[model samples]
Target chain A: MKTLVSYDIVEDKVRRKVFEACKDYGLTNVQYSLFFGDMTHNRREELFQRLRRIIGRQEGKVLICPVCDKDLRLSKAIEVSAGMPEEAAEAAVSYPGRSRKKARAG
Target chain B: MKTLVSYDIVEDKVRRKVFEACKDYGLTNVQYSLFFGDMTHNRREELFQRLRRIIGRQEGKVLICPVCDKDLRLSKAIEVSAGMPEEAAEAAVSYPGRSRKKARAG
Candidate 1:
């Protein structure tokens, strides 16, 4: 099944350990504290136990959710990555006020 | 369809606007930067456009994902909330070292 793991951890050290655990399972990091990947049922359970032990007695909440096929089909993604070098060049080219500002500076 | 929206926004003001927008759409906050809920296709599209405009030209990346049913059924959630008052009392009761430290202080 395709699994989605998300967590809220209070301690910095413990949180980092949890993050590393997710990565070790080959899950793709989707957001700051969210990861997505496919794992068998047995593996998922094993991971659950490992994560539980890692967060023992700490203020943390970890959720590992299995997503459905219909929902996956109906889902969508939107990404806006700003400040790329190419985009920066394009932005510089589009701005007409740059030369004016430079002339004033000189 | 159930939608899962996750974002990485660099600006505080812009990020907050995006966060508020997600909640406005009635999506439940799942993590620090992730939200989940069910919405129609048209509505998801609408949110996409709104989010794009909100993050316009800013250093941001937003993803809206659709999950499947089988995955959801197979998923698991683990929560470890530490430092609750009841747990604190339990810890104090269990740890004999705490009293030793107190005695040393005296």
Candidate 2:
């Protein structure tokens, strides 16, 4: 499944930790406080737990939204200037599984 | 369906318009540039179009992620000190339909 993770943290140290954690999970940074990635159900759960530990009981917030591949394909992302990275834009538009197969075939 | 809308805009005027558009759709502001709301599939589509119009060809980004109620219930939201508004927190944890019924019964 594709997931969109967004966060807002006040503490600088904690915020950096959170960013590193997201990257550690192989997630793509779409924006400053936003990330997107493809992960299995189990992996998603694990990522959530890791984030919770990093966040602890601090003054911050994280929202993990599970986006359906169908909805994602139907969704439109318009970039005026140099918006998201190529990889992030690809993740948003294409189904990861299918795209991986295409990559292999090519 | 529950939707998590997140945005990052460089222009002040466009950002304010996007914020107001989300509120007009009866969405709750979870953070400065993030919002959460419940809407039907059709309404969600309409909201998307409106956001696109507001964004136009500018240096802004908007991501609307649809969240399943079941997944939302399983999701955990922890607030340290005044994290999210009470309403936003409730939306994250409970099934909207069941919660509405409970409210009526009570």
Candidate 3:
């Protein structure tokens, strides 16, 4: 399932560690401090545990939520400045699952 | 339906406007740049259009996605530093819908 991870960490060092951990867990950083990716239930739980350990009752906060595929399909991304290249946007709107390559190319 | 909204804008003024707009739409700030709330399909679309206008091909980015209630049930929040009050957390874990009062009180 796809999961959404959003975090707010006051401490810079800990925040960086969490960011790296999320990346290692195969999530894509869609925005600063926001990540999303697909992973299995077991892996999601493992990631959650690892995150908990790293955060460890400090002064930061993390929220992890699963997002269904239907929701993802209905998701909207708008780039105000320099909207994505025409072809790239079309690819994304048409075949989101296959748009990664087009995105990379664009 | 519950919706997740995430934004990243280089311009401070525009970003602040977007933030205020989100609050006006009844979305709660979950993080500095992330907001989530429940709204109907029409309202979500209206908000999207308004956001698009505010952003207007500028150099900012926004993402909006619907989140199912079931997903919210499985969602997890961890606070590293000062965890929520025991009662508040328990309330959220037990009856999330009714935890708003407890959270506000705490």
Candidate 4:
């Protein structure tokens, strides 16, 4: 299964620490802090447990969610994977509508 | 009602265009390209439609995902919100374990 883990870290120090942790989990960098990766369902729970411990040590907090249908390999991953093209395609359409409103608001 | 929208845009031109759309939608900046904001369930479907139209014009593709709880305010939001702290706390612990393993693997 492919997991897109999005984490929220308050401190820059914490972000760096969390980034390292994500890299350890074999997740590829999609943005500055977000990650996309492949992990079996069984492995995901275990991975989440380990990530939790790291945050506990740093005195910081984070929210890690298992996002759906992200390309873990970044550019390459997007091309080869057909696990859920429909969902990704749907997002393509849904994303801009909100964006247009947001631009007008600001 | 809070929505976390994550978009994957292949082209930089497309990302910029999409970013504006997201800003227009009243979503706050949480990262370089990710957004966290509040929207009623009723508003969500409408928002998606608008975004799709925008993407169609761009000749690019994107993936917008409504992620789970992320404090849109960035800092103080985390404090005031008690809607889901346990999940965040759990992530704190889980993030690290995976990090440790990744460090070893690398």
Candidate 5:
């Protein structure tokens, strides 16, 4: 299934762990706290379980959603970084940790 | 079409204006910088143009995407505020600006 995971984590450390978990699951980091990609039902469940454990007693929320191709086609993404000086800044803004990287599955 | 809009604006003022525009378009505040709801192609284009103009000469990025019912069903939202005191805090974190009121949508 094509899943979209988004979260609002308070603690910086906790948030980092969540990001790592998403990355480990082969999900693409689309935004600061938003991840997107495909995952098997078992993988999604495993991720949810891990995220639940990781988020224990933390003041935060993690949302995992699905995205079909039909809706995704209608999707729009607008990125404006023309004001930045270096090309790296735009890449950094667009993809948080994968700047200058070739690409990953999304 | 079912549309999803997300933005990362630099200036607080410009960000607020963009938020107002999204709210004016009847989009639901699903996250801090994400909005979701149904909108015509024309409306989406209009929003894109307005956001583009608002973010001119500024460091920001606004993305508008689509979400269909099939994908929406597989979505999961988990909120952890059991340790927090007062109901308003949860409301504030989950849905900013629209606290203690009936929800517009998801």
Candidate 6:
């Protein structure tokens, strides 16, 4: 899993301390305010704990996003609408009708 | 799922046409390049098909991201490192070792 961690520190010293703590855990730096690499599930648990301690009460934030290279395919209907498939009468009704009748008053 | 549809058109006419086509399918516009609202699985399928037809060969991009309110929690070890739990000596060894013994070459 690829995780994105972002942080903002008030004092420059605190940021350095955070990086030192992360380096101690062997998490490779990826981008500005982001870290990429690997570790066992157990190690990750330990690392997170250590990180929380290092941050203390300073304002910080983190976002972990999963990365995938899958390419989504359009369905047959999609292809047809794109002019590759024959148009069928049934496909017309699939569109939602606008301006439905208002609810009857008691 | 919140779908983001971003398109770049060479001519203003093409951009207007795309919007007209989207409005025909009942997709409510959200941001400058985003659309959000309740859409049935089947409707989504039909919409994608029509969209392909409208765009033809124009350069465009779309990203569909699932929206949720779930908040991720740090594990117990993470809490401990934060100073909320007792420290275990075994946890000290969880950090990844930086240096390893060189492999002996025959």
Q: Score the docking of each candidate (DockQ).
A: 0.33, 0.30, 0.53, 0.09, 0.40, 0.05
Scored by DockQ, the top model is: 3
On TM-score, the candidate that comes out on top is: 3
Per-residue alpha-carbon lDDT of candidate 4 for residues B3-47, written as tens digits (9 for 90 to 100): 656665556776676688778888886655567676665565555
Tens digit of per-residue lDDT, candidate 1, span B4-97: 7777788999989999999999999866787878777888878977886787677766767665444544455544455566544223211111
Clashing pairs in 6: A49-B78, A53-B82, A78-B49
TM-score of the second chain of model 3 compared to its true counterpart: 0.74
lDDT of each: 0.66, 0.68, 0.73, 0.50, 0.69, 0.39
RMSD of 5: 7.3
Better of 2 and 5 by lDDT: 5
Off by over 4 Å in 3: A81-106, B81-106
RMSD of each: 14.1, 6.6, 5.2, 12.7, 7.3, 18.0
lDDT of 6 at A19: 71
For model 1 the local lDDT of residue B42 reads 88
Error of 5 at A42 (Å): 2.5
Show where candidate 2 strays beyond 4 Å. Answer: A82-106, B82-106
Candidate 5 lDDT over B6-100, as tens digits, reads 77787899999999999999998877777878899899888977776777667777767666665555555556775755443333222222232
Clashes of each: 18, 0, 7, 30, 2, 3
Residue range with the least summed lDDT across 10 consecutive positions in model 2 chain B: B89-98
Tens digit of lDDT per residue, candidate 4, span A44-76?
666665655555534443444454332111111
Compare candidates 3 and 5 on lDDT and give the better one: 3
Tens digits of lDDT, candidate 3, B39-67: 88788778877877776656777878888
